[model samples]
Target: MSSSTPVWPAGHDRRVLAEVDSTNAEAARIAATLAGPTWILALRQTAGRGRRGRAWNDPPGNFAATLAIPSGAAPAQAALRSFVAALALADALTQATARPEAISLKWPNDVLLNGAKVAGILLETTGQGGTPGPLAIGIGVNLSHAPDPGTLEPEAKAPTSVLSATGAAIDPESFLDLLAPAFARWEATLRQHGFAPLRRAFLDRAARFGEPITARTLRETLTGTFTDIDETGALVLTTAKGPVAVQAADIFF
Candidate 1:
């Protein structure tokens, strides 16, 4: 793979791979040894994972990547990457489009364009206790196309793509160029400022307050109304059982 620099924060190591089982998997392999920030950028993948062991669909022209952060950044702080990466993805989508306000983020990790899933983020961590020894954040964006809606997989209930929705082809490198800088800025902010501002910014983008939605997670599925976002980036919802805080859940409206 030809290496053009991706705007990264200090101590970040970028590895461009031809193929991988999964970028998150690869990042976990040597994360115990690496001291600085690092990520594996993959152009293609034979196999990839999604949240809760679901399969991640990786097509060329979309961004499929993983960022490995230090192990010490975890427990309560582990999920910080979701907002950090989502903010960058939001910025990336804006750079590629004339209309940026149309691009907003769904809590935890999903990029929405016109209220459809254009991209998804999956974060995994390894460590004893609550703190993560090393964190792997994998992302998949729909660049060239979203899957056929008629014969779509069950896992892709809300799958949408930039090209399919917009009907315009976007160069991956150009999109990445826009995303990397934004990512670098947010990463720094995440390390220093924490998730409060990120959560607020994300909520400003998520204008679907009190909207009836389906909530699915690693365990069960529930229908709830979108209420608000908490400081740690939990999805706050108003359910029949009253208010609930969800650390991770699949949101479908």
Candidate 2:
């Protein structure tokens, strides 16, 4: 299939591929040589991946892309871009479907429509000698098709698609046209004000806050009331022990 061309901002390197092992991997390769805010897009990813090393099934026609950029903030603060990605995607989908109320963001970086997962964001960083390097932000949205319920991993949330949810036959390229600029806007907000306003906007569209939820971390599982994300973007859980700040975890609501 011929790749669709979308206009990108100046100084940005955007590459569209017919097939690849993973867009994130490709972006990482580019980051090694170029000090780029580069975007790598794949029409079909033979071996896509997600957070925590889970396989990301990428069928042709779905959105599979990664944006790699140099890090400007400390490691902890740079991680907040995941939230920026989530908010950008939510905005783009809301505009595409014309259903602002139907779209919402789950904690961390999952985008949902009417409580079903429509897209996911994965952020990976490369560095040398403990020094921060380029950051690759991977995003996969189910535009034309979603995985069958039975095919999803046990930990994965229920999945849906733009076609299924909105009855709109949106393609990956057309979706990028909406997503790229929306992402730029949020990135600019993060650069100017910091996470305070971004956190507020994230909470405004956040789903299932102040509810009982389970957070499965690498060490153990913690159940608590979902309270808020701290100033640095850590998940704040009101557990029996106290408010636990989680830097990374798989959340279940």
Candidate 3:
């Protein structure tokens, strides 16, 4: 699988391989049994997933990869793990387009490219032993062909593709090569330094903040303006009662 190329991240050992199982599924299964950052990157995924357990679109050559991490992370950090991956993905797309401003971070784990959904991050977890044991970050980037944007979900807004956005074709290998290492730095940063700086930057670059929107949390749906994103990645919404810090929510603009 190694071409005339540097591996993803350049130096980190890549356990790059294909699998029939969903990348998230494979990551969860092996998270406890495997070593660190063993990536399950496949050219095809039969049962891909997205936030809120939605069926994620799986087109060939698109990135369906996840990284297995060690077994010692705080619940709050673990709860907000996607932020690390989100930041990493933003950096990756920025490299591909050379337009960092064009790529923005969506709360939770979505990646917005030029205001459209270019990618998303999903985390799979298993009980290893600690606060949050086995953790795997599953990321999917629209690198190539896809269903017409018109067919996307009702809530899905301005959709786009890398090949379309940057006006250049992007190879999955090239994208990963650029993403993996950049991801490690952000991932490690979140693990060590909490998410204050990253959260701030993420909010600043966030496409939608302080705007009236709808959110579906574990509890129920709420319509409010996005007021703040706290350090723990909890979204603060100006709800009817007052300001509520959201732990997890499926947001809609």
Candidate 4:
């Protein structure tokens, strides 16, 4: 970390690129060579992707970054970092805009501002020589621009930018300064305590809790009351059938 303007977190590496194909791709290419956790930020991404292979519309002023952490945890445990990243993202958004009340987290890695989509998270693992690899936490924020709603898939949340939503014109680098440290703090909490604390924290900021929401999986779509997140970070929905725990799905509200 650099001790310069926009004070960065200590014990972590930060690399800011003028442009890249994608921060997650860059992180995967450099994951094996890193000696410690590193944050990779790309001011512009020519080829960015979102969950389910959707294109990420990263305008020049928006945020595109990934935190590459060397990890040895099991795949299930590693996947839980999405929640960890979500908590950090919420914290950073609250700090940046000074509107904590406006920030809320959507399930399965989406951040909402004023009940609209403002940011998203994607997780991938990179390994070499059959050993456990680094976990890349890719985050994209609509800092200054958002994609047109017509381009979105059906039932996808409408997108909104920080500048438009709250009149906060935060640039990518300055936003990274806020995100990296906040992520570090939550990472420490996950390492020290467990998913219990993170689950509680995520639920506190969770959007649409106790409300009707629909989760779409590959096989079927399940609509139920958003009740809780379980011990393993599964979304617990109280459907008419019963209490169903969903491990992976696209949640819509």
- Per-residue CA lDDT of model 1 for 1-253, tens digit only, reads 1134455456677777888889899988978888776767788876888777877777777777787776566467767778888998887787676568778777767888887888888888888765448888787888887756665556555678888677656766556666667888887787788777787778878847668877788898877889988886788888899988888777776
Candidate 1 runs further than 4 Å off: 1-8, 129-131, 150-155, 218-221
For each candidate, what is the lDDT?
Answer: 0.76, 0.85, 0.75, 0.90
Backbone steric clashes in candidate 2, count: 0
RMSD of each: 3.4, 3.1, 3.3, 2.7
Ordered by TM-score, highest first, the candidates read: 4, 2, 3, 1
Candidate number that wins on TM-score, 3 or 4: 4
- Give model 1's TM-score versus the native structure: 0.87
After superposing candidate 2, which stretches have Cα over 4 Å from the reference? 1-8, 71-73
lDDT of prediction 3: 0.75
| lDDT at residue 53 of model 3 (Cα atoms) | 83
Query: Which candidate wins on TM-score?
Result: 4
Better of 2 and 4 by TM-score: 4
Instruction: Please identify model 4 stretches exceeding 4 Å from their true place.
Output: 1-7, 127-131
lDDT of 3 by residue, 146-232 (tens): 547666777776667887777656777677887787777877777588678778778877867878878887879988888899766
CA error at residue 182 for candidate 3, angstroms: 1.3
Q: Which candidate is the best by lDDT?
A: 4
